[model samples]
Target: MSLAFLLLTMGLVCLVAGGALALNVRGCAHALERKAAGNAELAMHARGELGQPQLVMSARLYRCLGTVFVLCGIVLTPYGFLELA
Candidate 1:
């Protein structure tokens, strides 16, 4: 029972972190898009390389965090059962 509760708490924490990270990454992309649109030189530079790449990297990182959270939940679930046994 204690293990179950612990696992649940950890799972919730992971889910929250994943969600926050995902939202932050999306917000960053939206902000960048808006910034790029306002100035032609900025837009051209954004299109050239660096700007889009960073956004993509951040998005991938969030995706990885979400994946890790899910995996941790799965792992903890079985471990919780073992603890009960």
Candidate 2:
């Protein structure tokens, strides 16, 4: 019920979400590889380069977000626990 407990809960939620994001990204990358197959352009995009740059950017963004979320969750949860105790 305390602020600390709220922070802890939010932190855990973020951590879990981050983990899911990571898993999703793994699947996405695999799918991209498969889709690229023998297409030079598509393969370039899959490699995060000269084709569909957005794909690369998006993947990087998601990965960055996942890391940030997990880190924030780790920091917040411990701090919340300390406050609660």
Candidate 3:
């Protein structure tokens, strides 16, 4: 396959991976909130100065995946352009 095709394929893969990560993170956050809601202590703790560990971890993962996707897209664009040249 041509370099352009390869780049496009990789870019699409990154986007899909990032989307999946984001969805997973959102799901986890919701679940954690729901679980914490049942326990007043947990809910209070989550709302206090210290945030929910699970939610924070999930957000970090989502952020990392999003950054990777963006970087991949940016890199692939140049590669695709070069291939066309």
The best candidate by TM-score is 2
Angstrom error of the Cα, residue 26, model 2: value is 7.7
Among these predictions, the greatest lDDT belongs to 2
What order do candidates take by lDDT, descending? Answer: 2, 3, 1
The digit string of per-residue lDDT tens for model 3 on 1-85 reads 4878888778777766655554655575345445544465576677783543443334455556666776777677677767877
Q: How many angstroms is residue 37 displaced in model 3 relative to the true structure, after the best TM-score fit?
A: 16
TM-score of each: 0.42, 0.58, 0.44
lDDT of each: 0.59, 0.69, 0.62
Candidate 1, 1-85: lDDT as tens digits: 8867787677666656555554665575345444445565565576785443223334456456666776776677666666767
Q: How well does candidate 2 score on lDDT at residue 7?
A: 94
Go through the candidates in order and give the clash count of each: 0, 0, 0
- Candidate 2 vs. true structure, TM-score: 0.58
Clashing pairs in 3: none
* Candidate 3 structure lDDT: 0.62
Candidates 2 and 3 compared by TM-score, better number:
2
Which residue segments of model 1 deviate by more than 4 Å? Answer: 12-57
lDDT of 2 by residue, 33-85 (tens): 44444365666767788644233335555656678888889898988889887
